[model samples]
Target: MPNKTLRVERVTKRYGALTAVNQLTLTIRAGEVFALLGPNGAGKTTTLEMIEGLRQPDEGRVWWGDVDLAQKPAYARQRFGVQLQNSEFFELLTVRETLELFHSLYRQRLAVPDLIVRLDLAEKQHARVGSLSGGQRQRLALACALVNDPEIVFLDEPSAGLDPQARQNLWAVIRQLQAEGRTVVLTTHYMEEAAALADRVAIVDHGTILDEGTVDELIHRHTPSAVLELSREVGRDVASALSSVQRVDIQADALLLVTDQLEKTLIELVNWANDHQRPLTGLKTRQATLEDVFLTLTGRSLRE
Candidate 1:
């Protein structure tokens, strides 16, 4: 496969009064893992669908290198692998049998048993799809997607229902895909998943991109400040007096002092508390993270 960037240019999709995606544009560099991250109803799923050629954008275009996806839907179907948000398979087929069924549809594919083993379904190769656990089912869906030996893989919430260990396992598989020089695009709301897997990330909401960059870039750009939390609420005046503090936020469970100089702020707060004969209860400090960046941009929790 040629090393060409996958581009989504000014893509927009709408359903009645709701605009699911708004002039969204981004690029996926060849052989890199790209993540589209946002909360539910954030247009993440719609964006993936449009690029996978499963759903048409009401406006704009998608291009894999010089080939326009809109103009060549078969080109996408032959080269792009997609694992849908909801992948339904025949219930009674064994795992291997299902993989074989999908393999037969494509001109190029991994051997059914090899694909099953690659997905870690070796032990359950004969297990009926209906009897497989949620994680197994997810792996089967992934296996089906790979049966086409696609150049670009689109995964929508690939690890949504997976447990911690299973999620890590899947992350390893994604990393392997990257190492093998395949472009991967996955949409996820899990901050850690995106941070751990993506070479670059685009944070999207309300059908448009809010920010796009490496995880560290987004965090440092939007939330360069560290957070110092106190168990009890403190007035803005008190927090503002702290050294190098940028702002103060009153969270439901604590008072947060946002500061560029974390060590200086904590020292100042401790000295003030000592002088005033008051305890700085439950003092905790942490560097800003992707979650903070998301909240800073969207003004809401990512889980929302």
Candidate 2:
């Protein structure tokens, strides 16, 4: 199969007065795993739907290679595999049977047994769809999407309800897809998942694209500094007076101090606490992360 480049050009989708996706433009390279990272209602799903040709954009173009998806959805569908956020199957049907049913719908398809084995579902191949666990069900969803042997795969929150081990297993499957030279576009609210699996990520919020880059690039661009976290609350005025502190953010139970000069800030913070007679509980220092970048751009946690 040929790897396909997918592009979303200035896409906008509105629901009455509320814009679900606003002038979002993104280019997903072939054979790479691109993740859309955002909180709930952040237009991640809407953007994916528009690109998948499930919903038409109010104003924009979605192109899969030379084909405009909005104008020729059937052609796009034939080339792209989609796994919706909430995938439901015939409960009575066995895993192999479900794969067979979907395989029949596609002109080009992968062998059912190979697909099952790739997804580590050999033992559960004969199990009823409804009888599988949450992770098993998720694997089955992915298996169905791959049954068509698509060039591009779109997965929306594929590991949403899975446990840690299951999530890792799902990530492995995603990596295998990338290894097989398939273009993968996924939407996720899990920061660690994005950090671990995505080659590049687009951070979206309130229907707009905040930033797009690799995990390290985003952290460097948005949070090019170390963070000093303290459990004790620090007043904004006091925090602002600290030397070398660029910004101070107050969380529920901690004070996050962002600084470019880590040494200077640490010394100043220590002296300030000593002078003020306030104990710095749970003091810790760490490098910036994708989660930090997300909070920096959106002013909210991914789970929020």
**Model number with the top TM-score:** 2
Can you give the TM-score per candidate against the true fold?
Answer: 0.93, 0.96
Off by over 4 Å in 2: none
Instruction: Write candidate 2's Cα lDDT for 118-209 as tens digits.
Output: 89999999999999988899999999999988999999999899998988888888898888889899999998999999999999999999
Q: RMSD (Cα, Å) of candidate 2?
A: 1.4
Worst 10 residues of 1 by lDDT: 247-256
* Residue 115 error, candidate 2, Å: 1.2
Candidate 1 residue pairs that clash: none
Candidate 2: residue 83 lDDT (0-100):
98
Let me know the TM-score candidate 2 reaches against the reference structure.
0.96
- Deviation (Å) of 172 in candidate 2: 1.1
Q: Please give the lDDT score at residue 92 for candidate 2.
A: 99
